[model samples]
Target: MNTIVQASPVTEKSRQLVTVATPENAQYLTFLLGGEMFAVGILHVKEIIEFGNLTEIPMMPAFIRGVINLRGAVVPVIDLAARFAGEPSQPGKRTCIVIVEVQDGDLSHDVGIMVDAVSEVLEIPANEIEPPPSFGARIRADFIQGMGKVAGRFVILLNIHRVLSVDEIATLAGVATPGEGVAHRSGS
Candidate 1:
């Protein structure tokens, strides 16, 4: 005797094949400043280096920790906490310098930003992003792109162009004019 085996029929819904479109996610290099997490677009980040001795420049803003020689290039380092919140930097083992490319006037300068810690690169979906709050942010809202929801908390996404504006940095650098004991004032 021959036996016939029947296969289960596929339903219309099953045949439709529900495809969860992977949401377009952006990758950001996350870092910690103070107690909060902040992210910068990965495209701008060049490299991360351990905190080390920096050559201090006179007459510069307090935020400008000074410059470091990286492969023969003089790159200025900015303390993110001091620059944003006007607080002093207390670097620890996790402290690192994230070298980035910033544009100042007609010049594109390579600058280093010091962070409390270097967090992992995060892939955040666009839908999970929210607009920057008008009042809740510790730093100026203009400096932020929006708050990103990550692991049930918000990570502040920085608008690098605004946060590291060349004009602003130049202004800060200009505060210490040529001569007139810039080094003494900066404690260099």
Candidate 2:
């Protein structure tokens, strides 16, 4: 019989993984931000891209770095650091953007989160996951989905939906609907 292999939550701490057996498994895409590890479910991940060609929008919040032309789609890129109440990210050599799809009511929107680097995807058994703590996290507690144990360490699994809530972000940033938001800059 061919054993089934699956992905789980993981963060590379000198290349180690941790897990526990459960009836179901989950996969997570791990990445780094400010030297800390974070993961998001693979289902939400659309693609990962090299960070570049950002068209900065005026008067937007710091976390809303700008928009990128992703295959003709205007995907907004977010700076996780800034969103987490830290200084803006200074793009590094390993900097990249992880594209994720978020739902707003009946519609879906694509958003990009810039990270310092992309780590490997791993198969995390459900039993190894722990509930989010009430406190002691760098980011807001509500933003965490769970904590995944990995090789005696921990990876902060993010509640991507809550973290990237389209409605909340737009409202907080004072962004208007597409038609009313951006003014065309001619020959800039």
Candidate 3:
């Protein structure tokens, strides 16, 4: 006698994928300033360009180097060293401009920070960063985002927004607008 065996049908159910919050991992573009290493979050950085001619505006703050024409858009360049209250950095062969976007309210401006040299981009785990110290920092405490520990070295991560506060700079410099058609050039 032959027996027929029946097999059960297999059913597939749709599964929904869910995402969970994870630790933040940030990347920074490192650069040298005054023989020390500094960094800024890569997201804020637009591009790195060769140091070029800048149209100097008169009566501007000492840290405000000048403005450069970037693809027809004027970009103000800041002397990072000078901004830190140190002597201005003399441009060298490796000198380059790091373009960063700073936002104010609903408007964003492209500002260039002059660095002695551009270093490598590093991926630093968020946990490895330490909060900015309350005192003894060469630059203002607000200017530092955190101190990133990298290979036993501390990299000063700059809070670009604080360092390049558009409103504050304009008010302090008494300039109309940085990178805005070279305003305030009459009173040198």
lDDT of 1 by residue, 135-186 (tens): 9678998999988999999999999988888667765676432233432333
Alpha carbon lDDT at 127, candidate 3:
87
Range of the 10 consecutive residues with the lowest summed lDDT in candidate 2: 1-10
- Candidate 3: residue 141 lDDT (0-100): 99
Q: For model 2, what is the error of residue 143's alpha carbon versus the real structure, in angstroms, after optimal superposition?
A: 0.3
Tens digit per residue, CA lDDT, model 2, 1-188:
12221222243532332332234868788999999999988777877777777888777779999888776677899999999976899999899888888877777889999999989777778989999999888899999999999898899999998999877887767765444564343342
- Ranked by lDDT from best down, the candidates are 3, 2, 1
The TM-score, computed over Cα atoms with residue i paired to residue i, of candidate 2 is 0.82
Q: Candidate 3 has which clashing residue pairs, if any?
A: none
Per-residue lDDT of model 3, residues 1-188, tens digit only = 22221211232210100112234757788899998999988778777777867778767778999888777677889999999976788999999888899998789999999999988877789989999999998899999999999999999999999999998888778756645654444554
TM-score of each: 0.78, 0.82, 0.82
Kindly report which residue stretches of model 3 are placed more than 4 angstroms away from their true locations once superposed: 1-23, 177-188
Most lDDT-accurate candidate = 3
Measured on C-alpha atoms, candidate 2 has an lDDT of: 0.80
* The 10-residue segment with the lowest total lDDT in model 3: 12-21
